[model samples]
Target: MGSVVFSIDAELGWGFHDYSNPPTDRIESARPGWKTLLEIFETYNVPATWAVVGHLLLEDCNGIHADHPAVDGWFARERGAWRDRRDLRFGPDLVEAIAEADAGHEIGCHSFSHVLFDDPRTTRDIARAELETAIEVARTFDIEYESFVFPRNAVGHRELLAETGFSCYRGAADPPESRLRRPLEKLLATIDPQRVELVEPTVDKHGLVDVPPSLFCFRFEGMPRAVVETLAEDPIVRQAKHAIDRASRTDGVFHAWLHPNNLQAERDARRMESIIAYAAEKQATSDLRIETMADVAERAQ
Candidate 1:
């Protein structure tokens, strides 16, 4: 039997701290959808890995951490930017919700501040600090993280992750060499989407299981987002269902991921629910098992 994995990049505002003009509206829009997603997963009996930012688990912060790596104009220390924005930065309530969900979701790490590990600015010491902080914060919720998702999916300082007791991390998808390939894929998906890529989990040199994603759960950028609301079927949902079927037949893993913020739109929420429902149906009849990233890692081991 093949397995299906769903992982959510649940970073909230930290995911956008680096943006010059952060999408405040979009960030706020994502809050209500978190519960909606949890309900959907529960209904389908689907579990997922929620890779969260460390800071979000905090009850409160004093607005500065002297020990943190020195990034210029750090948003956390900018009183005007963050002092009154606690609603966006702190999400222990949401974390608790996921932990308490009946679907058996796993909580994983996504760094402390969403710092880019691949950036030269994030040295080995900084990376260690990030991991340590994340681990320390997770303990407050009585959670130990075995799965790690790179902030921005920019992989780096992986040995540090291994040293910090991480058992697995999400691997980046291989990008096409030709720049035009992306636009071409997007155009094709609009017409008739293809089955997403399937991957077998592998343990890398650092002894961390690499569970690469098959597809991101979002509509193509230039495509009409409202098409899902009007059409009888969504292209993205069709693509995901095709990937799940292929994975079952070939004994491969189909991993799909997205940010909670991606579910703000009503159409996007409906599309995600459809995908989850199809996966559940496949699990009932076919040789397809729904699994979390942690579950896949344990099986690989």
Candidate 2:
């Protein structure tokens, strides 16, 4: 059996969402959190992937349209962190900082405007336009991002990806429910990402090596860390990771990911560090072919 493929994603959106107020995580929590995680990977010499948003690469969009009812209401409802502010300007030089930090690492695409592909009319032209935007931003830093991780873990628009000249798509993974559903999710949540096998119909059916890691190893966005840590002892995350660890049918890849914002809590930093340490131990103990999304995607070609 070949080794496993490991990937990490830092989802850089515009903001976070709070049920009663705007999310306070995007700038304050997520960006720095990711910086710390990336440093961890660097220190361990771990080859990881950063599935970044194009908005983070571009110069902040200036001039908010608060006059427009829709624009004003959008930020009000979803107060989360993004690479840029609502009007397109960031509070600081975060965009440049990421580009500089991404040197020697795989800087992959999360889409130019994550919403473009969401459009039903996302033709090849529009798709390339969106992808090229990210490509162009990467180019500004002299980094060529060929790998792609679809925004929202939605990689259905393979047409756009392939049309834009991408080699692979890193999409969603199997839910823990099918196998040891409960326990797996719990353990995986704490130890590693709950990265089940890729059980969905994606680019693979069309002969593409759709690279997906185990997922749902943790609670998704807006879910509190207190709730997630409580569920760490839950049966779901545990069963999921156990299945992956002992599976005879494990593939050339073992992948899992989540937004860094999910780890915004004070204690989450410790939890995330533990997870990274565990993955490092896994690499030492096994011959698993752990990799960044870019590495596997390039291999698919």
Best by TM-score: 1
Give the poorly placed runs of model 1, Cα more than 4 Å off: 76-78, 176-182, 189-192, 219-223, 227-232
Distance from true location, Cα of 45 in model 2, Å: 2.4
Q: Write the per-residue lDDT of candidate 2 for residues 223-289, one digit (tens) a residue.
A: 4434755766433344344543543244445555666665566555555455555556666776545
What TM-score does each of the candidates earn?
0.93, 0.69
lDDT of 1: 0.84
Global Cα RMSD, each model = 2.0, 6.1
lDDT for model 2, please: 0.53
What lDDT is reached at residue 268 by model 1?
A: 73
Off by over 4 Å in 2: 1-11, 15-22, 63-104, 116-125, 173-195, 198-207, 220-252
At residue 141, what lDDT does model 1 achieve? 92
The residue-level lDDT of candidate 1 at 64 comes to 76
For model 2, what is the alpha-carbon lDDT of residue 138? 70
